[model samples]
Target: MKTLQQSRAIIATAILGVIVSTYALYVEMAAESKPGYKALCDISEYASCSRVLTSEYSKGFGIIPKESALEVPNCIYGTLFYCFMIFLATFDHIGVNRLQLLLSLVSCASSVYLAYLLAFVLHDICLVCISTYFINGLLLWLVYNKNKQLVEKKK
Candidate 1:
């Protein structure tokens, strides 16, 4: 029964993550249609989405921005990362605690960084981005709680 509950929690988190990601992606794509934002192929510097996506902060080790390439919006990366959180939580629910712990930590850190970017750097907060951040926070909390419960059970 406890396992079932945990499984449901993980699944619910995943679904929420996917929903937030899709919405964020939609916003990113729509932003492209605006005059200031540019498609990834365009590299000009007048408030271009392409500029942000291609920037050093976009991804690690020269990997292209998956979210931008998908043409949704750069913010969709948070959505996708949250989706990964769900996957990790599910794996943890199925008895893989280490993966879950590592991923959740990553999610927590990413969420903080994203919030910082939205609030400080962008100086503009989109509804979808805010929603995704909230969801990520909730999922992180849940993952932490589950891990705590597991530790308690062991003791």
Candidate 2:
């Protein structure tokens, strides 16, 4: 069984994720309107959220799936991903031992890759994106520890 604190942490992180991703999506959409517009997230040259967002990789795997036919903001995917995490946390076990841990690992892995792209490939940092990545990493850590606690309790 997960602890109350663990559950609360998960819920809080999910809520934060939703807020961040929604703002990111808003920035993305707002860009389509104004030509020279920049989001408040665009803090500086090295850490320009808007520039990183407009990069080719921002479309995410949709680039390969849609074959560039569609360009969906990565924020949409992040929002949905966090929503799923919240749902799972609220519903309890996913009928598979350590499923939540597995999911977190996958999500964190994706975040790591994206962070790499932002840092090394794109040569720019996105404040909003970095914050989301941090949240996901924290969520993964919390959930992983909770999974360990569950295993220990069973023994």
Candidate 3:
């Protein structure tokens, strides 16, 4: 059984993830409107918000443009995922274990992919992006730690 404090911590981390992700998405959308703000866009080389956003790489796997909807970046999907995690953490009355495991795997995978973007693809760190990564990493860690307890109990 998880302690109250541990449960609260997980919930807090999940909420943090949602907030950061949402903020990143907001910044990405806001950048599309102003040309001057394009300089802060994610991605390496061109580094221009407008350039990367307009670039083919910004598109989904292939044909889909990242900012096709509401002119918001695809990265917003990450934020949405975090928000789902927050929902699971705060009011998980069904399959709590399964939810935790799913969140742990997704958060871990997200952290790894985002790190790659920061270190290799982006080559530069935006404050909002960095904060999102930090929150994701923290949530992953907490989930992993909590999972360990479950494993121990089963042993």
Candidate 4:
């Protein structure tokens, strides 16, 4: 695929990522952290995003801490990750492609793990979280398709 088309798709996907992450962040802040604050995404007791988002797993410093060991909100990290993807897509460099690939892998793995956590560990599902996972899967597909086309063109 041409760089222009791929970049456009990436930009769109990143925008979607931002929207989803922001919604989750809002839920985390307004509903999860606060009592008696019902969030829009909180469909039911079994599908309570507030509950899952407020859990201990919702915050961490990731695999490696660059400067400090301060535990950060997962939604905050996700929002930043999506915004970084927007920056990467806008630049349209080889380095951006590599970074997107790395990001996609982590997104996919984490989504899978979260899904498993919901099914087995948590015993409840978050609709907002599932939507983000679906978005991540879409991003993975878009990146794979774009990279495959590039490889095909090179060969």
- What are the lDDT figures for the candidates, one per model? 0.57, 0.78, 0.59, 0.77
Q: Candidate 1, 102: how far from true, in Å? A: 2.2
What residue pairs are clashing in model 1?
Answer: 28-73, 29-72
Residues forming the 10-long window of minimal summed lDDT in candidate 2: 90-99
Ranking by lDDT: 2, 4, 3, 1
lDDT winner between candidates 3 and 4: 4
Candidate 2 residue runs with Cα over 4 Å from true position: 61-71, 94-97
Per-residue alpha-carbon lDDT of model 1 for 75-147, expressed as tens digits? 4556566566656655544356556667767766776776576456755434544565677677666666777
Candidate number with greatest lDDT: 2
Model 3 misplacement above 4 A = 38-72, 91-95, 151-155
Question: What TM-score do all the candidates reach, one by one?
Answer: 0.63, 0.87, 0.67, 0.86
Worst 10 residues of 3 by lDDT: 53-62
Per TM-score, the best of the predicted structures is 2
Model 3 C-alpha lDDT per residue in residues 1-155, reported as the tens digit of each score: 47445567877877776776565555555666765564444555434344433433333422465456544454566666666766666643435656766767776675666557655775545555556667777777776666666566567
